[model samples]
Target: MMQMPELLHSQKNSLFTAMNRFIGAVNNMDQTVMVPSLLRDVPLQKRDPDHGSYLRDAEADMYTYYTHLKSIRNEIEWGVLREDQRRKERAANTAVNAANLEAEGEDGNDLEQLLQYHLKGLHGVLAKLTSQANNLTNRYKQEIGIAGWGQ
Candidate 1:
């Protein structure tokens, strides 16, 4: 089993720390999955029944998810979204802006409340990403018939 590097005490609660941990997990997954083709056609949720609800609507193969994970890592590392993501973001923003225009009045605490909400959601997302990366690495080891891998 691989262990992630320890974060500094000051960085423990920051968004960067969470993202860094997620990146490390994905890097481990990328290194472990040397033969990406081995992941082709494999379902993401078959290994754990509890994880099915995490991506209930996704039927994409493991290779698709592997590439997606790499793309997410790249996005986080480069601090830039892919064109498709940017497009989606633009659409979502337009809708959000329209909604905001419709509801004009807001207290000063709204910004803090919104920030807290997003921060909590970001932490949840980062944790899920880390778990997915670790799971993929383990699954890759299993696919290669590694015996007693986690023992």
Candidate 2:
């Protein structure tokens, strides 16, 4: 029995791997790989409207939206990694300062302020990414006749 954290980690890794493959397929503009890859993971409902077997008409648009979303997500992931590194650096610096006792008067508030600013920016970027991804996914669902299971 996997622990909750282990399961979550596994899920996250799987999602990232799938997204990476999807990104590669989009970058190569290989519809043969991209279409089947996406459709294989997304199960079709019997009640879904017949928008053609492979949802052929919507594939191009969906790919465009998905690629744009992938770019946004990349940016967000970069921001998060940057913030995490900054946080670790800040903690290490604070620990060093505590050990020194001499730099206490110099004020580490500036570092804290900068970290807060970066975190806020990262938060904004992530929020925008989420919104964009959600919008694109919903649009794709609608176009492919998977929005609500039925026409």
- Candidate no. 2 TM-score: 0.38
lDDT (C-alpha) at residue 107 in model 2: 58
Model 1 local distance difference test score: 0.82
Which runs in model 1 stand beyond 4 Å of their true positions?
A: 1-10, 46-58, 81-107, 147-151
lDDT of 1 by residue, 19-74 (tens): 99999999988878889998988777644466655453268878988999999999
Determine the C-alpha RMSD for candidate 1 after optimal superposition of all C-alphas.
Answer: 6.8
Q: lDDT tens string, model 2, 1-151?
A: 6579978877654545544544443333332222424533342222225553333333344455565656655653455457778899899988897877565554578768877787666555555545545544554456556675423
lDDT of each: 0.82, 0.52
Worst 10 residues of 1 by lDDT: 48-57
Alpha-carbon shift of residue 10 in model 2 (angstroms): 24
Off by more than 4 A, model 2: 1-62, 72-107
